[model samples]
Target: MTRVVELVEHAPAVGVALPDAVGRALAAGDIVDAVPDPYVPGHWSLRAGSKVGAVAVATPGNDEPITVRVTPKVPITRLFFLLGYNLDPKGGWRDGEVDVTGHRDLLPALAHAVERQVDRALRQGLLQGYQRREETSLVVRGRIREADQIRRRFGATLPVEVEYDEFTTDIAENRLLRAAVERLLRLPGVPHDVRRRLLHQRARLVDVAVIVRGHPLPVWQSSRLNSRYQHALHLARVVLENASVEHAPGALRVDGFLFDMNKLFEDFVTVALREACRSFGHSARLQDPHHLDEASAIRMKPDLVLYGPSSAPCAVVDAKYKAEKREGFPDADLYQMLAYCTALGLREGHLVYAKGNAPHAAHRVRHAGIVIHQHALDLDQEPSGLLSEVDRVAAQLVNTPRV
Candidate 1:
């Protein structure tokens, strides 16, 4: 006998129950959809949709009761498929036959899945493109591990080992996605510069981190990073826009490019921020442009704004990419970051400069109860080596009492 199960979201603890067939379909990562039918008695047809996250399966008829914990305010679509019986050619009904079961909600599910997939693809493409720009990058200084098992009659023994390699690839590909979109916009016969300018604007919209004491580094491609950026952009846009639409191929491509660019910027910032946090035993979030307060009115935006573990302001960072470091100090950069610290009620801020510039001494100044720091990012070392310097700097920040 086929069982009828009702899927519902529970309060306090949010989760969803999955049937055996549905679980299997999700695990297999099928492309689900609903289509109009003429020959069939039903008005609609049900099928698979695009894949996003990984899936796990449960044994059939076990009924152990499955539940999935979900993020609050995040909408998830659940699809139902028909299983159990069908009719035979000999005029007898067959038992335990599974086929497509129609659901009114399937259309929206398909749209959501496609949207996510497209976003993911675009982000991945961008990261891959950036990594391709440079090769032989330095690996971060951290232990890496993999697992192995030795089987015996009594029991299986699991063992693991660690290695330090020169390759540590974790940069996201959103930047590459932006590049692709710009390329498409610049394609011959497309007269609209608006699209091209929009693409450029999107490319410039990125979170940045400035490493103070690191060697020059190489760049590499990462598909995983690209996908993540794409998803983040999609979520951000969707939340900001508050709606969905049919899957447009051109729109998908454009979105993919934007997402990739966003991801690249995010990754770069994350690494630098992580290094700072690790050194100081603190953490930070990319500041939202919408949350700027009156104190920071003069300094509109900063590359990075760090926070203490208690959510207290730590430091403000601004990143610059220049082939040559300025003689003495960059006054404009210093003033801008100092303004951010003053506005955010922070005590210290930093100006991080890119590599290939003439090295200058670190500068410190106190203004309006805040200290502004100017340091250069050494791109001459590997990524890992550069991160080590970041960690040291963060540690110093934490050890030193706030002045």
Candidate 2:
């Protein structure tokens, strides 16, 4: 038997056996847990983590796919607006793209919309085609590989292995786009016919290394024409890396499909603050590495490190998912921030968190120069308003001298 499970971000899918075949794949970090259901006594619920993807489970009775689509819990408009500010920054990346508003499943919807944009971009012709180095064996080619010629002289015209760069449509960015699209096609939530069309579209581009997998796309590829390409690249990144896919003999699963809004909120703020600091006549370091121990072996990584005009540490700011009231760990953040302040010899540090009933709070250490400020970002507000809050945070971090 197959099961179709649907869950909200960080929600649980209760009472699903999920078959024996899928057990291993789920353990391989697909971000799910089997726990006793609180609502149902003496029964288990398949719990979900923060990820979103299609889980394919193979059933003995049929060839149908078992899927679990993880949807966002927050308002779609809010999330979309946040993404727009972070992705486009100045309204360039989203120009000419389909509106993501009202999509039932945001992940697949994004993948599909990206596919359309890719198709449209390709129809106009690939932008910035350049020579790529490829290794191959050929009898008559631009260059000959003497090492391969001596080893694999199979008495064939393809014996002369040659490595050379060729100008072709296949590029790293295209490969990444294809890889993401291909992964999305496995999603059961995506319409089957649309999957077929996506497969066809992906086949047009030659496969290449997904080198841009864990890293950002190259800076040189930024241009007016590459706008769509860049957006697809980011979208593909969300599909390929953000969403988790799992499979086994009788089970293929995409169960782990959740996005951590906490992290998203933090990253958006930090990146914006970094840029905003530049405008405020200061330079900022993000995730700056520092040695926390005398041995200089233990490393301490802070979310954002603000530096003064004199190249000294001005302030440090950390982002938290929730406020101190709900999270109940402001003290831990205080300890960490104090270390940052002491290392830089600054008097204060800042912590940003999502808005809660007790959003704004402050703390001061008795008989010490250290102080920590806790501010809340009203995520429920409009994106522009949220950004304005970030601007205020920036001003608070840098207004004092030596900061």
Candidate 3:
């Protein structure tokens, strides 16, 4: 049996007694900060930040494994919506496409969603496509590499180095799906049924090669042929990119999947704002880079920058997962936005937060005359309402004077 410890995002730290090895591993994991209580013996205070997921560490001589499950402040459903929208804004995820009500935590919900998506993707059978192959073969096939024949083989005639495009089911799309299935199977706390389904999905992708760990994944392009696989592949990428496993001395192993709310919020806000801007004939650049200083020594990347018909940056915006101050947006954020406005020669800027003490506020820098607006977006609302809020923000940007 594995002992389960639960924590909430941005909540007060909780004290729990954990094995010394487990405690130290959690401290070093970067998902949470574990501080040993100075007054309490054998106890550690655990606090979670923006990252949320389940991490399990097993210690030597301990019969049971300890799993730390951090719950996100945003509802899991809405979080998935943000993630889905970010992954593919055009046609990736829709309301009720991924059902999360069945699972209690992130890991299980992710596993379930991934399995279902993969199953849907493979419903028509594994997609087969051409993959480039380069190898030495006894029989001559495709184009032969003469340089390699002279260098390594030394003009050997029997074995030839050839390159060819082989048509097979083991393409990048299937491999990504298989990799996500395997990743979910390895993580802690997946429901038994979901695990079994994931295994089935793996069996379907038996011919696909396992992606080499720590190497860049094989690239796949979106086309009409692979249109059915786009959603599954996107979700699969999320699994592979965010999950990790760590091995320590004394046979201790730590592994889990975590999603950073900050990044998620930023991605969602920028992408959504970009979509909204497009509807109004304005173009948006995500993470647009510019310099804050005259010498170009200080570099800055605003979350989203809107460009007018003349191809000049007319508006700048930054996304905050949550506001820093309890009364309103943080002063530091306002200061940063002012810098963005000043550097970009824009008269106004916007800061969007996931939530805040105030719904909206505007500050005018005394010397600069640059006005910074802070807007709070409630994540708990329906997807339509949330996007409507984004539309309102985009409307404001369109109404701002050209810089």
Per-residue alpha-carbon lDDT of model 3 for 377-398, expressed as tens digits? 9898899899999889999998
Top-TM-score candidate index: 3
lDDT of 1 by residue, 263-302 (tens): 2223444455554575456765554352356564533655
RMSD of 2: 4.5
lDDT of 2 at 334: 72
User: What are the runs in model 1 whose C-alpha is more than 4 Å off?
Assistant: 1-270, 275-281, 288-299, 323-330, 358-360, 366-370, 397-403
Candidate 1's TM-score = 0.33
Error of 1 at 217 (Å): 31
**TM-score of each predicted structure versus truth:** 0.33, 0.80, 0.95
Instruction: Point out the worst 10-residue segment of candidate 2 by lDDT.
Output: 247-256
Tens digits of lDDT, candidate 2, 197-279: 68777776644444443466442366675765776666566566555544343434343344567667777778878877887
TM match of model 3 to true structure: 0.95
Model 3: lDDT to the true structure:
0.87
Query: For candidate 3, which ten residues in a row score worst on lDDT?
Result: 322-331
The model with the greatest lDDT is 3
